[model samples]
Target chain A: MVKVTYVAHDGTRTELEGDPGDSVMSLAIANGLDGIVGECGGSMMCATCHCYVDDDWQAATGARMDGEEDMLESAVCEVTGRSRLSCQITLSEALDGLVVHLPEEQV
Target chain B: MSAGRVVIIGAGQGGLQAAMSLRQEGHSGPITLIGGEPGLPYQRPALSKAFLKTGEADKLALRPESFFATKDITLRTGEWVDAIDREAGVVRVGAEALPFDHLILATGTRNLRPAIPGIDRALDLRTLDDAAALRAALDRPRKVAVIGGGFIGLEFAAVAAGLGHEVSVAEAAPRLMARAVSPEMSRRFRELHEALGTALHLANGVTEVTETGLTLADGTEIAGDLVLLAAGVRPNTELAEAAGLEIANGIAVDAELRTRDPRIFALGDCAAFPEPGSGRRIRLESVQAATDHARAIARTIGTGTATPYAAVPWFWSDQSNLKLQIAGLADPTDDSVTLEDGAVLRFRDGRLTAVETINNAKIHMKARRLLAAAPVPTRDSLLQRNYDLTAA
Candidate 1:
């Protein structure tokens, strides 16, 4: 398990522990971290799980795949280099203490 | 009232999502999610596919039991809400009358049972329980006749055919999924199903249902070991209508999903609201619409997402080798332009309205993003870009 911080639109931080294989989206939802909606259940079909990975956790998460990069474009706010779908990122030691920003809209 | 205690009726996708979204949007008020179905609320999409194939009922749950405690949300499943007293804003489930400050109706939809003989012979695929029963029925050797060539019927036919069972689909429409897909897409799907060894009977509406078989409009009786009904759905508007709420095709709602009574709101397939990007009104049966609707209601009741909840609509269906993804809503009147990438962009007048893609996720996502922007791409420019809609 890994502890991660989810920062909402209003700048509130929710720190929670997530299982290794579970996604950032699933854990946020399982923990009720607020603002993270994994509507498609990690099918990568719906981009409701969109989130922003901070600079500190970007490299560990690696570059977005073609499928995710394309979906991220449709995400709520302007897609930055840091934007990523939380569903694609699973919890791992590499992401311990990782922090991601929830977009203003991800329903 | 102080938004005192928010009471949500119906624990399907929309109901569960209503409570979850409300809390997510920062509403700390007393939130309750009540579902008529037993056990945890699960997704209905898999009823005809994965669950029908493997019978893995456990995986389909929308959330774990601990989620309620963690989020401080209350879920009352297997309990039915008998009445909604709009003026007093109290819901009755049998003897208990639960009061509410704001009542949300996410009751969703149910299978439409057509008036046909021997209707009881056919099985359904709407709820988790229904899928479980169908899975057991598929165990024995049986020839299946599916009524209604919509997505659910076609999906089940494909799976049953793939399982070495002889399957036949009888649809009243001239083509498969006529109500949901374009003619081109429908034709393509027809060819795919036929190639999979499933017999297709277009425009063959079931006139009469017999114990051993179903008689079509053309007077042809197709014999089957078992019959399945996938005749589509009708909104569960009894609670709303009984409560004196304005009812159209569904419970009529404004831009905010609020019912005629401002204290109550509705969403999902049961709530027919004005279509964003277009003035037309429509109801959608998909996970995206339900969750999006839930979030919108939550924002209004929780934090303030005061902008008229104009989120773009999207949908998807999985059948055998094809995975159809649609972004936005379009009707038959919309002029459709097919892009070079096998993606079709639909438009009403000159405005882009929806995008249809098969097995092409990239184009689908791009189309959604493009439409999200104001002054969406037009048919001319979209064609110029070879339908590379991302050119925006």
Candidate 2:
């Protein structure tokens, strides 16, 4: 299981354990984490699970694909250079200590 | 008056969301979710995309089994609701009669099977069971003949071709996705599918489904091991229709998502609600519409706030490397303005009706917000800024 930390907009952090191959969006939904609506269930169709990857772990998260980048641009929250769709980021042992900040709102 | 008990039919995305939203909206009432499918409500969109690629059904579940138990939501699966007893205020599931203070019809839709010889031989991709069967068929190398060049068919063709299977798409219309996209966008998709090695048969329709292949209307035969019917879908409105509720393209609902009987409401693919700005009765099959409609209905049922449903409609389809995102609604006759980056802005009578983007979610989102503005952006306003929606 990969240990991932989801920080809410208000700076409230929730550490959760996610199995490898599961998306961070699924993990958030499974654990009942607020601020990650995941309306489209990781299809990248809905940008409801927008998250900002911590600057330190940005490189580890790697670059966003064109599809993912397009989704981020449509995200209800402000898209930053560090912004990423949690659905596109799969949980892996290599990124065990991943930290992502949830946006304020996801429409 | 708050609903004492809410009974939701179909138990799909919209039904499940209505149940969840009711609770979230502070409705401390008994919620019963009845589904025709055998298991929990799962994400239907992933069945064609990620689930086909990964074969992980568990990952597509919208909520875990424990969610219902914890939330005091009663989920009954594998049961088909047969009829709605309007006067009795109950729904009939075979011999059982389930009563409700308020009833929500989220019966969703089913694939439209054309009246062709041996049409039963063709498979569908609407349900999880259908996807599972399709996936099992894809386990071995097989030739796939898709009946429709719409989103589902194209998405399935992409996956089949990606998996090294021979695929052919037969679309009756001159262009692909003709109902939802512009000519330019359709041409681009045709190119994408052709480049992916999927044979395109546009302006031609299947006349018959043979055991080994399908015969076109013009007597052209396409050889294939498996046939898929992705032509389109029809709303499941038998219950509402039988009960004497208004039925047009779907179950007709008013601005508040209420049927002729205020106690009965409908949403999702089954309900034809008026388009927010245009007032045109439209039935959407997207997850965004389902969730948004559920939320609006739940708010009205739970908090007694009869706010008319007005959320922006957006949709996306993932076919191979291309991701098509559409914001707002567009008719086939709507004029389109193509941008330099390949995004198409649809306009009707000078007002923006929709925006279609290929792998451009930023512009799609911008268009959705812009269209939802108090006074929608017009053709002049958009052209003045060169279609830069953010320049408001």
Estimated TM-score for each candidate: 0.87, 0.93
Q: State the lDDT of candidate 1 residue by residue for B13-91, as single tens digits.
A: 7788888877766787898889888898887887887778878676577777888888788889889999998766689
Clashing pairs for predicted structure model 2, backbone only: none
Every model: Cα RMSD to truth: 3.7, 2.3
Candidate 1 positional error at B207, Å: 1.5
Interface RMSD, candidates in the order listed: 2.5, 2.4
Tens-digit lDDT track of model 2 for B9-85: 98999999999889878899889999989888888998889788888887777888888988889999999888889
DockQ of each: 0.36, 0.48
Clashes of 2: 0
Off by over 4 Å in 1: A1-36, A50-66, A75-107, B1-3, B304-307
Q: What is the per-residue lDDT of model 1 for residues A1-104, given as tens digits with 9 covering 90 to 100?
A: 79989888899988999778778887876655557767776666877888889989888999886578777766767788888989899888888899999888
> Which candidate comes out best when scored by DockQ?
2
**Native contacts conserved, per model:** 0.41, 0.47
Counted clashes in each candidate structure: 1, 0
